[model samples]
Target: MSPMTRRTYSFLRTSRFLRPHIIALNKPPFAIPAYQIRAMSSGNPTSKMLTANPLKQIFSQESRPAMGVWQMLPGANISRILARSGADWVMVDCEHGNINDAAMHEAVPAIAALGVSPIVRIPDLQPWMVKRALDSGAHGILAPLIRTVEDVKNLVTAAKFPPEGKRGFGSPIAMQNFNPMPTFTEYLQQANGSLLTMVQIETQEALNSVEEIALLVDVIFIGPFDLGNNIGHPIIEGKMDPELDEAIERILRAAVTAGKKCGIFCTDGEQAKQYADKGFHMISVATDYTLLGAAMADSLTIARGQGKQDKPVSY
Candidate 1:
């Protein structure tokens, strides 16, 4: 029997009490109350409900940590390169990066083509921005400057679809990210729960409400640049400042307590490893621009040692 058939048979066989209420096995899955179905499955104890999104599956497994790249430049080439770089996901930055709507449209597919999840970081908590990101086939959203629980609630609504949220869905392109593409109804049914909502806790206001926000979103991401700046320490001498470390600890505690994944921005692999050691579920290891800059600088140094010095190339 197929998994669905097996589940159905198991539910009917084990849930003798539910048989009286359930019309028939031929009835649609939606016909049964969702809670009763959950109860039946929970009672069975052998079945597992899995998330369809590739990136989310990383967090679903406890031992596997998620490592991602920050896409600063626009286009499919950059996105494709990063996606195939063995990272669990890629964060296409629309907020800080030069990516616009046009670039995102092209970039998301390239990322998905590599079977990697594309997470878009929108500039603000605007619904239109969230809708545009989602419509472009993004698997998740990283919303910055989330200052309160209310902000998180609105962002969640914008990210999710009807019944659970108010996000309007008509994107034919969005399902392209799914492997063995699902029908629109199947996609809609899973979309609200599958897509991740990562809220950046950067400001003092956000830090204060970290516990509540942790309960609201899937991931609690710390924007070190903004967090340190707002905390009046500016992340000078790395993110090791006592005050900033305390704040990071606080946010980490909140997420751990709420049973949510925690993430943070890192400047390089070293910093990323440090945070990962500290138990961050997700880590943005490095950005395209930073990698490129370091590569070019190393190449120039190699050329200089070979006595092949020519005119310097300026950006």
Candidate 2:
């Protein structure tokens, strides 16, 4: 048998559940049982071999929306702290945050090692950016400012592997986060289905094609601030425009109709909870920089003998 086939056989042979099925069917190792494939593809929380992506596991197992935090700062130590703080996922914000390619590489494994799925928010829908984020061992890539169905298609093509997409692969460090990491062959076989492909609906053009775009990606994420600005209803003086609210609802409805997950960016727990209650699948509760500033400000206010008061700005 070829080395790749041999590796597959060896991996299957080690699985007590699969060994009997393989022998009974007299099938090639590549022909995994339908149930096993489902377990792997859907990230069965009970399946040891297929639980590499914590975000996927949470999506499969939990009824509540996956709560996430945005990482604007650029340290593996900071990433680790966020990962351990009860978040289901941590977004390494490469788009607008201080995180660059090198910092992304540093953050992914650190976050993943703590069992939190590290999602990288790339600056744009560029193929090279997708490759870099995925190759760094991220559980997902969130591309910002996607404006067309073709853009969604290109994003999917750049994120997936052969037959499904044209993404090229050769990352030696990609599987380092998984406990008892799978073989390279196993990682390659599962990465496409296991990793998330999220695209942002931030532009007016994107809002127009939201339904079609929703059908293409794993998650349809809303950038509330950008969406408002692009649609000529910019959130002014901390107030949400009714027209922006309508656009956000339209995007949510489109995602629901497409049977796809919808996500949104929120400034605080209260805002995140409101979106979660509206059936958003994923919600970013806060950003590192903003949270830090807010906390400091609150502490100072208390120190100065002023009782806690709500911050008016929403974005």
In angstroms, give how far residue 30 of model 2 lies from its true place: 18
Give the TM-score (vs. native) of candidate 2: 0.84
What overall lDDT, based on C-alpha atoms, would model 2 receive against the true structure? 0.83
Give the distance in Å from residue 295's predicted Cα in candidate 2 to where it truly belongs.
1.5
Model 2: lowest-lDDT 10 consecutive positions: 36-45
> Across residues 13-74, which tens digit of lDDT does each residue of candidate 2 receive?
67885553333334453454555343333333344334778788777767889999999999
Could you give candidate 1's per-residue lDDT for residues 156-202 as a string of tens digits? Answer: 88887656678885566787676645444445556766778899999
- Highest TM-score scorer: 2
Each candidate's TM vs. the true structure? 0.81, 0.84
